[model samples]
Target: MSTDVVQIETRESRLEHLPISFFASVMGLSGLALAWQKGVHVLYIASEWVSLVIAAAAALVFLTLLGLYGAKVALHPSHVVGEYRHPVKLHFFPAVSISLLLLSILALNMWPAMAMPLFAVGASLHLVLMLLVLNSWFNHDHFQTVHLNPAWFIPAVGNVLVPLSGLALGYVELSWFFFAIGIMFWIVLFTIIINRVLFHNPLPERLAPTLFILIAPPAVGFLSYVRLAGNVDAAAHILYYFALFMTLFLITQVPRLMRAAFFLSWWAYSFPLAAVTIASLTMYEKISGTAFFVISAVLLGIVTTVVTALVVRTLVAIGRGRSACPNRPARDPGRLETQ
Candidate 1:
């Protein structure tokens, strides 16, 4: 092939390999933004602007990914369909709607006008994605026990996130509907995931970081429940404490997580920690407990550190043209980064 023709194909190919899972970065960043927002109030931090800047960055990243993925859809329909069929990556697709939901929350206090539209669109889109995902799983031909991972928690857990903003948007009944679906799915999937972990082979390194996703459904569920229910009660305690327990459980795996190879999935760590941090801050706000304040402070600091590390590592990976980076190496144009 001519050099110009070869170069053109390589560029197009790079765009095609951009995975839908990159939206997890937006979820992580927006979670950090909300955590910082809560920290300022609960922890008496002076750095509220940190939240603004991170929220803006999250929005920017979301737009960029939207445009890029939109291009991939237009130029690479087959590749998109392949991802839609893939057992694992299929779940990550909902991250787009969830990111929108989170960005809606980030915009809530600062821009209520913007927040409403974002929430409306996010809520509507998430329902569609959730249905599609369920249908796929129910009718799938190729799924098996080994295909199960914590990432499967994304779609269901994402529903529990609605009330965090949906309540404020005056969608009281709708918010409850989403929350119920999310909780039911969470219970079902939580059992299946636990069973898989106990009886099946251990998750490979690439999927290990996804264990962090276990923290999000409960943490986000706690935050959403308090907003919807107007106070922390017995049920709230169950969600919050279970999430906290899961967080601690995962901490013991820190040594192994630290040793695992870098994957796009590492972004998995950011949002759950952020979820728990925001939950802690909320708990402190409601009860005036010094312990909740301390816990929130600790979690906020850890999530900030984790996000910073992820950003630096992502930049380095992109520069070196590694797996899952946007600037994928031309030599491997056909490789899907999400793998």
Candidate 2:
């Protein structure tokens, strides 16, 4: 009995070490809220109340995780630093900033007064975080063949997210600037990722879900471009079509994704799926047709189901004391890394 008790204590202790990357849950939840909000306008079955409820839930989760993570930082500053220096896990920091930006966008129609301040804070923080991550990329020689994965998109794609609400909040010029940064880096990163995949081995199974992140930039870029341009022009069509093509292309990898062992990293799939769903809904709005509507509906359902499953699984893992901090001991800090 004493041995069993000690084992339980050890398991419980692991919970205290939960990594900052858990903020990925906030990103997933906020994405779900935003997707539901878009669904309210595009689908007859969706309602404003449902969207508001989901948004509220997401806000609560975000606050709760933020507080928990803050506590972890206070108690284990070294662990936090370890995560920051980690090749793969370092990319997840932007998920916190992006989740904040997403929450601000979700609040725009629900509470405009609150939305502006939230957007201001989120946008400023996102820019700073993006710059910091970019600086690390340039100055830090952490690049490694093993570190190349889709999570690298988090910092780059986060810039595109700014313009989603920035345009609506009257920061048109700044939004365009951020949009340009996001798009330019996305192309550069895409080339690097593809080249890595062709020349190097595939990403480890645990990180395969992050491959879904490849879909987010084009989809989000399409939505942001349409909002900024204020129309479905030729350029908008190009973005939309590219997003559609990427989504279709990535769908082929679903079997490989599912075959991998489940981990918190799987949450990487959630926001990207939500992004493409929102993009589809945006297209349906602009090009009113049965086909677009059907596509939007299908993608929304898939994203909602996937995110829900991931949330449930994560909660269960936490309850069972199986979901511990993701940071492992640091290797050579100067290796070129991408996650």
The best candidate in terms of lDDT: 1
Model 1 worst lDDT run, 10 consecutive residues: 327-336
CA lDDT, every model vs. true structure: 0.88, 0.80
Q: Against the true structure, candidate 1 has what lDDT? A: 0.88
Residue-level error in angstroms, candidate 2, position 198 = 1.3
Q: Model 1 off-target regions past 4 Å?
A: 1-7, 325-337
Which pairs clash in the backbone of model 1? none
Model 1 Cα shift for residue 113 (angstroms): 1.6
Ten contiguous residues minimizing lDDT sum, candidate 2: 329-338
Winning candidate number (TM-score) = 1
lDDT of 2: 0.80
**Candidate 2 runs further than 4 Å off:** 1-12, 327-339
TM-score of 2: 0.91
- What is the TM-score of each predicted model, taking all chains together? 0.95, 0.91
